[model samples]
Target: MKLDFTLKRFPINGRLKEQSGLPFSCVLQPYHRLPEKETSAGDASGTRSNSIARCAQCYSYINCYCVFDTAGWVCSLCNRHNALKPQQQKRYRLDPTVLQELPEVRSEVFETLAEDPIPVPMPALEGSPAAQQDPGYVSGPAPVVVALVDTAAGEEFLELVRSSLEAALEALPPVTRFALITMSNRLGLHDVRASEPSVRYVSLLEPQLRPGASAAAAAASSPAVACPLSDVMPLSSLLAPVGSFKGAITRALEENMVPEQGFGETSDAEASGSGAAVGPSGAPGQEAAMSRNSGGDAAPGGGVGARSGRSGGGHLPAARGLGPALVAVLDYLKVLQSPAFASVKTPDSEGGLSGHGSGASAAAVVGADHLSQNPSPVKLLLFLAGVPDFGVGRLV
Candidate 1:
């Protein structure tokens, strides 16, 4: 035969959803080991260009935002944990080194809340039962699962979440167990309740491994009765019905717990634009500062370690009745909206959520009345940190 040319065409789904935008994990695959001579040439630069290519700054799972060459993805919890910087590191002075040295801590619930939280208790809903004695409908409490999404880049993102969680827990009654879920694409659920006190090991729940899990569970985790904190998990999708979730969450609080008077409006100096107003310095259980600051890149490590490696953090607890909690977190992102509104930004607009038929106009459906119905009050607390700069206090 003179010549043979065969072309295999890759299939294109041809389904056009949304138009252009700016953007954009590999774990394992079969590969032939290169000879020592080839490896030596690759290592000659001494830039650690050989081992494995990873970001200098790594998260707990696969990196969602890989802009920083120094950044790598770990798990969502670790992503939030790693979002903290050196200056902000003081807030969580738990001594990770010491924690790492401790033996595994079993299912002991530790209340991180302050002895007395800021006392602005909202009026409780009238007539709601303290405990539901009903059958199938009431399954103890919805499992608690919290998912911390990245509002912006920087270590502060993680610190903000940690501070918020500590403050929230301090406000709640003591619990026996908890779990933590952080997600971008890949979901990681670390069972904090399962760990033996002193030892640090996360029981990872990977989505790929278990495809049957609900988006909420995959995004967050099951809200078992024991771990109340697990209620905060990733939402079904950014565009799902956040208000419905909020309503359910609010009902849960009114029935089972009391709303704490935690944070208040910020004064001009303190309210200089960041989400939360800057509270007094050294206020126990309070985040020292709030700013729109970004994070810096960690120094690079040899190839893959920096790019793909786990970030460290303990497991979080699961909470009872978390469906609404998941909804509240989803709503905070300002992505979900009713179908009635038209598009706000252009189809190709990069500012807000895309992929939906409507663009910026999509946000119009997220009205205050909708948020008022939110079942979970805790989500509102979380949304306070992520909402855009506006009169948020008035809106709440």
Candidate 2:
């Protein structure tokens, strides 16, 4: 691939300081295949082998950029010389025409396989239970999908999400693992794999607050608590096998109705007017409306808008807690995509129950290895119905 840079001379120094007028960024999608190479695997010259020419210092694969001579090859990345093995030397002595036919020597991008005389058995490390339970480990990484829905949105928005998720389920391969999360004033984790699937609540504000103290006191005493997504649920439980839990997932989506108050108050004129009249604390009329909306039965004291009286705890009148929610989910996605973090074994009990112990970790390692060797491919699909009005990047 050709690289175009704004600077006249390449910045050889490792430090990448911000330059006033220089556009120093480029986005390339390597995985996107050309029309001709879409169906085919390009050249067939590259094969898997135990040994291959690579950079001694940087470990970069031997490619068209490398300089080859009688003694050794010079790595283009680090400019280090790597001596050729006996077999490599013999291959180098072949006819010029035969050497040209080799994909690694000619093509910019080529495939390779590890040389394996006998398949090495996977080791069952004692500390990592995730690697011990599942024996039917696959060779490649299965795709993963995480859905973050804004429960503060309107009925129309929720309906659209339902339809979109249904379509997504149909389009995704059966092997794909999926997880669902919802956010309003707080975050909700839907455990679809449970015997009786239900939405587990995670209080975004309370967790950050001091026990028996007000929300204001918490904010005053300490910075907002950063809750890791993994802490919300075990990694094994959070992601469910889509094939088996499709129905449960659909039900979770269907049941995600807007809360009576909080951010959802804007959905109804009466609630909004009442909210306005009562200011940020939430009005009696709004509470009554919320109660009536729930089949004329009063919502429990700890229901939505209960903490509106607390400082910084009022119902979000305009844009809800979209910013923090998105950040949390995005952080979780980053963890999922990271090889080192994703491959870490879960507890033995957790792995045993999920039946994905060593198998899952192995898949993660393989996926990570593929990503490290090749350009990592990722895509983020965000579904939003309103503006982000909480924490950083708030528009309203």
Candidate 3:
């Protein structure tokens, strides 16, 4: 099979381009025939391995482009040197078959990994959005859809977003839960279960933020957002059930969300020929692309669930307080609790987002490994109609 692209680059000004724009989906046909020399498994079907080598930093699968050495291999994509396990090192020295059998090393295009995510019993109130649950009994991991709306994106552009989100709402699985956040110099968290369209505004600005750094870093560096995300809205309310609360979500998008004047060029700028380069990358908006972080293992579950996707939070000029908000969200999910994210204190029984946050550093630069690594994947869709001209990561 042949492949093509829709965009050119992935990141824009230290921000994740997955939230940039366009569709970059890959349809994996497991039953398709493989090229003659491509299959190391000696069949038309590709290699089936229980384990695939992955970069500890970026969580990307190791591919043919990696440079292998005596100690370990350097990730071709992130250029981070990942040490091989002792057993893996021994296997590399003793048995040449290990390298020969790795699908990532053998095929440059594709490979099938047979990962068996433990199947959980469907929750009793599955798809019943209005259903309440035992506060203590957390269900399995459910796919989280956080739509970060740029409130400054005028009515016309927002209308397009409204329709698109509505269409996406129809396609979502019954168990999926979604969170809505509106940004334009400040942050607003929406509770889908509220009687009316309820959005609590949050100021996430820190006294000082180093330029060209991610929001994740600022949260790690200084005092976090004015309040925790749950403080703005509880996790239970944040992740509203798509099945029952579909109408509520649509209403929240419409009712009182008026566009705020921003510092960037108008929507007409793109049509009039603005040459800011954007690329087609498999990002959180696309479920499949979002799952790439966890070896594509987490089947979009919730509570007691762990998955990883694109990490680090980008702060737009129009979206200022976004960093602390995301850190709060990740804290709610316990993303940092995973060893992959950081080496934190042993979490006690009490569960809540508190001090010593996990995500990025106190530095101006956001490292690739200092991001969403494993076991907690949150799909964040940043809806922007124009380049941000206000805060950090501004196009200007």
In order of lDDT, best first, we have 2, 3, 1
Candidates, ranked, TM-score: 2, 3, 1
Expressed as tens digits, the lDDT of each residue in 1-396 for candidate 2 is 223335543343345344444566754555655445522333533566444566769988776666777678788756788887786776655456766666666765555665644332332332356424332222235556778777666667778888999899888755456778777656666655443344444544322545798755654554221456555455445665455557767765665334424444453333323222221222111121122134323222222233232112334443456656666666655645565323444355344432222123332222232222222233445677777665544566
TM-score to true structure, per model: 0.20, 0.51, 0.49
> Alpha-carbon error at 307 in model 2, in Å?
13
Candidate 1 lDDT over 1-396, as tens digits, reads 011113222112223212322111122323545455433433323222222223234422222221221221123222232333455234223454532321111101111222333232222222334211110111112223343332222345555565555555545432201223332211222212110101011122222224776554543443212222222221221112211223322222222111111112222222222222322222112111111121211111111111111111121222121233344334433422322222233344445542121112223222221222223223333222333221111121
Residues 173-263 of candidate 3: C-alpha lDDT, one tens digit per residue: 6556677777766666665554344445555555356799766575456644556654444454456657657777777676535454232
TM-score of 3: 0.49
In order, candidate lDDTs are: 0.25, 0.51, 0.51
Better of 1 and 3 by lDDT: 3
Error of 3 at 111 (Å): 5.1
